[model samples]
Target: MMHKFLMSVYKEMLLLKRDFGGLVILFIMPLVLIITITLIQDSTFKSIHETKIPVLLVDNDNGQISETVKQNLNESGSFEIVTQIDGKTINEEVAREAVFKGKFQLAIVIPEKLSKDLQLKVNQNVEKILGSFGMEDTASVAQKNIKILPKEVKLYFDPATQLTFKNAVKSAIDKMISKIETQSIYATFQDQLGENDAPLFDQKSFISFKEIVPKVNDKEIMPNSVQHNVPAWALFAIFFVVVPLSINIVKEKSQGTLIRLITNPVPYAVVILGKTATYLIICMIQFFLMVAVGVYLFPYFGLPTLDVNGKLILMSIVALFSGLAAIGFGILLGTIAKTQEQSAPFGATSVVILAAIGGVWVPVFAMPKVMQYVSHVSPMNWGLNAFYDVLLRNGGIGEILPEIILLLLFFLLTTAIAIVYDKKKREV
Candidate 1:
């Protein structure tokens, strides 16, 4: 059984080696894509990292908290704050256009009622605290006297903007808002109590920070370029396996190899398993080779080192599901496709479409809300998320369990469909 499986794998490998175009498409093409895109994105991320992103700040409030938040943002050095465009203060439509046109990375709008909202929140918190201490009527009066509506600082950015750029701006904004909020709480106490007396509320006590690091030291962390493209192009290449596998299956059936197999002493399941084993091995090779390029060759091109966070076990599980899902899809496509002409276009088109919607070409967050929801249906999205859990998130097996289960289900569904169709074909 083992010998037969080995033979099947050897045969596929030989065919793959001989098919120069297939070899290039499945392996070389994705590698080139990874290198090219990573290099391009690396420069952009590096620029953003090295220099502050340009952000348009539309401070409509002109109040205490808004001014403090603006001051904090300016002092943070994460942004080159643009208060004016072409000798005029930022206009909402113009700022949005600037962001859309790539003139600014982000636009932040501080609403006119920010100070009032913060004061209201403080008053409500005081009322709730007093109510807890059996002063219900006094608390009710305080709450009724101060009508505080909810408010949020509106952040504007282009839907097509890169994830890192958007995240940096958000992080900076969050910090600024936090500082203003802390001050607001302090100011509320100052108003209630005399300014000379210390405020009872400890803002630091209300907020805390925690850092999550991989098992490895901080210096060994993987770069964003490696973090993204490795799994992305690797999964893409693995799925592209469907094209050649489908073509081979169609060719084999046409040439009587499949017919000859059924007549042989070998069981049908072994033949199917052999083909699956062959493609699984091919997928593993493609993944490892890409990892090798990302780890070793990428540094030469100014990409970050992928000092793996000792999550090879987690990554291996992801790779297993990824390979299974690809092979299962290939088998299903093979079972349904009658000819190379049919399989080739269908397989290639499906992979490309899946990749586009799956956050392989672009981050899912950058996509429109509808597209983001639609992306969940793609197996590539699940695979990419599993990879992210291990690679970027420094997650354990438990963290990626959901994605693993989903990918497994995808594999089972596609393989079941293929098996059902095959059984029907045989019965007919």
Candidate 2:
């Protein structure tokens, strides 16, 4: 079996030696991509905020009424208005044009009546909170206290705008509201009852600093980029790398080379294993190159530095295996695809979509709840999270065991499927 496996690896190596494309796929390309992505993410195109709401302000109430409304919103610090359109630009022409241009996420035309509306909403919401209608109406609530009604803030988002971006902004707003609400409640209590016998609420801390290596805040910043990014990217970068290489496999089969190999005294299992082994080696190299470059060069692009220690080493190994899983998955895809021309689009599309969901292209925290849950099935998310746990979370090897186990499972499953597929194909 060892002899057979060695021969299989040798055959794949020979093919690669002749083509020389494997080096680029496994090492050079992944490194280049890692650098590029790191640069884009770390660049100071804008300040990172807890939640930056791209709101448009149309201050129609130019007098103290509008100013008071603006002061309240600003004091909450829940949003970052991208454009502050003049009160004079409150016309339908300006509003429609701005909306079409996508200058802001939500538009707020502070109608001259905004102050009155807010006071009314506040009074209504507070009244609802107090529950003081009539004696008969309070019969059901006689035993239990009523829940605090959430402050009803109106949103004026353009429905035609990009849904994903819009949702992201909305989430920010929600987070901001949740954060400020505790304070708002406390302040209201203080105003109503003073420090005497009123309900005491601890003020929530604002996220003025992120936990980074420099120890910018109370929480420790993540130690390295590898833990933070590698797991997400292992599958992401390899998915891209696999498309071209896997398509080559389909090309070989279509050109009759695979069929010819089947008759070369080599077991079909051996042949398939050799191809997969080759891809694995290539992927391993890709993983190393991307990580090495990312550790040293990432800071140049404004990305946080990767920590180098036991944690870093372990993350690299686990992430590399994930890349191998991706390669095996690609091989399995190639074997099933039947034709190169037909395979290319499907393979590429699958990788891209999986990568996006896997948190390769974006932080999982940035994704919606549904996507976050859905991505759990993909190897990319596991790998990315493992890296994060190992590096950033300062997790030991034991902590990352689950991710490594998952990668091993993926490899075993894909390899088994590839072997079975090859056997069936040869039988035909």
Candidate 3:
């Protein structure tokens, strides 16, 4: 039985080899696509990394603090602040519209009386702190308790934009606010300290908290473009096996070869198993070859080479699961498709739709909430997520357990349905 299965597998390979042109195209097209896309996206990411995020600043306050905020943003080298154009002032609504229209990634509207409001906020904080510390009777307490109205700056941003840009803008704004408030506090403290000359309060021993982000190792970071494209194109190419696989199955069925095999002494399951094994081998070859191009050929194009972090075992597992899912999907399509015309459209269209929904064309996070929820059912999403977990997140096999299980379940479910359909057809 095992010998017959092996022979059947070899037969599948021999038949595939006969269509050498299509097979060669299948292997070459994904490599070409990955390289081309990586090169194209390289320039975009490079521009973002080399240049500052373009932001529009609407300074209605035109005050010292607002000017200082604008100066700080420009000096920080993270943003190119556009305040006005052609001697025309930009308003808050225009800034908001610019962000919404993608003219700018961020828009900041400095409200009127920003400096005064900020100064008032500082005084209120000092008064509250003094009261909490039981220093309400202090001579400076009455003067500090004078509260000023607070106003908020309106910030406009597209929620769908990348979070990194938004966070950078937010962090810069936070630092600007901190600086303004600290300066205010310092001025108030000097006035109060000079008057009170409190001997009980040890100014020299004052402790303050500081925030710092921990440093990451240089080798730990992978370029986002490389990480995304490598797995994305690989997933696309592997699933594309559906076309040829389904076509072969349809050809055999229409030619009466499958029926003849069913009438022969061999168990029908073994022949299907052999064909699946053949396609699985093809899937692995496709994966490794694409990875080789990424690791070897990409550096010549000024892109980062593929780095697997020595997780070959986890990588292999993902590839295996992806292959199984693809083969199962192909089998299901084959069982349903009665002719070449039916198989071609169904197989090709399904793969395209699945890839689009599964985030091959766009990141799932960037998709609409409904589509993102719907992406969960796509096997390609599971495979891509598993790849990203390892390549981008530096995760191990255990981290992708859920994805792995889902992929395996997808394979089993689809293959079972196809087998049931095959059995019913044979009985008829």
Candidate 4:
């Protein structure tokens, strides 16, 4: 009796050892995918504009003031300028129409009336603030205060225009103020941005859309970057574990050993239990190796852990459960698949597609609506979100309970399907 159990376990181990290609994929492939995806997947690039914001510039003034504004906007790189000239594409109607096509996020119509507006408003604020200090309200007092944006600098962005895009316009206006000879004019708004003067505009502000810019929560709490990766990338990593597990199970079935075991006194449940147990162990080992190595070595890799010692242990158990769920899924795939050839491609393809939607490779948040909803079904998203809760979110076991339950549910459902499939296919 002992020999039979040992044989089964040993056969599983030997299968792993002999299939070195499998070993490479099971272990190394994940690390490679994680690193590659993490680098390109999230925006780490330090662009002033992290997202490409579209801008439409209508230079109604067509003079030095409008030209300066145009130059400043271009230099800001906060915009992808779509030039409209004369009545053709340059009109407000045309610019507004462009927004519907998803052509531009914002439109800047430089009214033919800009210079006079700046002269009037600049002097008014300058005289009011500087004059309040008991100084004469002279031309010098007005000159000293002309730093704020002129009222003529009108903005007509779609309300849907992002806050960042709106802020970019204001920032560009600020940069323009810095270029003028009068220093005191813009000094009042210095508390906002640019302690150092921006002499001439530079293209360094062009934000690469491929990179990720972090969003700060309302609270003072700022997290490490890994916690950020945990939500998306780790989910991706855990999901792909199924590919290896499925291939492992399909191999056993293909070699005729699974058929031979049915004739033995061992119950079918025991066979499934033993194999599932083996996979669970393999996956847990992998989970720890990734977490440990990621924490100690690849610090950039986002794999979070618990702050409370007990919770950390519980988190590991949760991860173990998630891995088991993945293995259960692999087993189902193996049983239903007529041959390893059929199983291998289908398993790999399923994971690749599902993981993509789950935000392992790219954030599921970034995926379109229907796919995002579909990803909720993927175990990777649940496991990854749970891992995030423990590590990055500083969440407790209670927070991850739903994820744990869902993972187990997936396991039970997949196992039931596999049992039915295996029973029917045994004769074939």
- Per lDDT, the best of the predicted structures is 3
Q: How close is candidate 2 to the true structure, as a TM-score?
A: 0.65
lDDT values, one for every candidate:
0.80, 0.64, 0.83, 0.65
Most TM-score-accurate candidate: 3
- Write the number of the candidate with greater TM-score, choosing between 2 and 4: 2
List candidate 2 stretches off by more than 4 Å. Answer: 1-7, 21-56, 60-65, 72-96, 104-106, 113-219, 222-230, 251-264, 356-376, 424-428
- Candidate 3's C-alpha lDDT? 0.83
The TM-score values for the models, in the order shown, are 0.64, 0.65, 0.71, 0.61
Model 4: colliding residue pairs: 43-211, 43-212, 44-212, 126-145, 147-185, 147-186, 359-364
List, residue by residue over 1-428, the lDDT tens digit for candidate 2. Answer: 77878887886777677767645554565566666665554433334443455566666546544565466556655566543366454544565567667665576554554444444444344445656543222333422443333234445667666777567656755665455444445554454334646456657575576543634357556344344454455556666656766777787788887777767666766776676677766666666666666677766765766665565578667766786677777778887888776677887788888778888777788889998899898887778777776656667788888988898888779878977887887779
Worst 10-residue lDDT window, candidate 2: 134-143
- Model 1's TM-score against the true structure: 0.64
Ranking by TM-score: 3, 2, 1, 4
lDDT of 4 by residue, 1-428 (tens): 65666666676777778878766677776666555644553444334465456678777776657777767666766556777535456777788777655666677777765665555555566456656676544435435544545445556777676776579677767567545424334543341223456633342435545634443354433354344553344444555666666666666667866767877666556666767767677776666666554456454444333133434576676777787777777878877776768877888788787766666666677678898888898887788778767765667789999999999998999999888877766556
Off by over 4 Å in 1: 1-6, 47-223
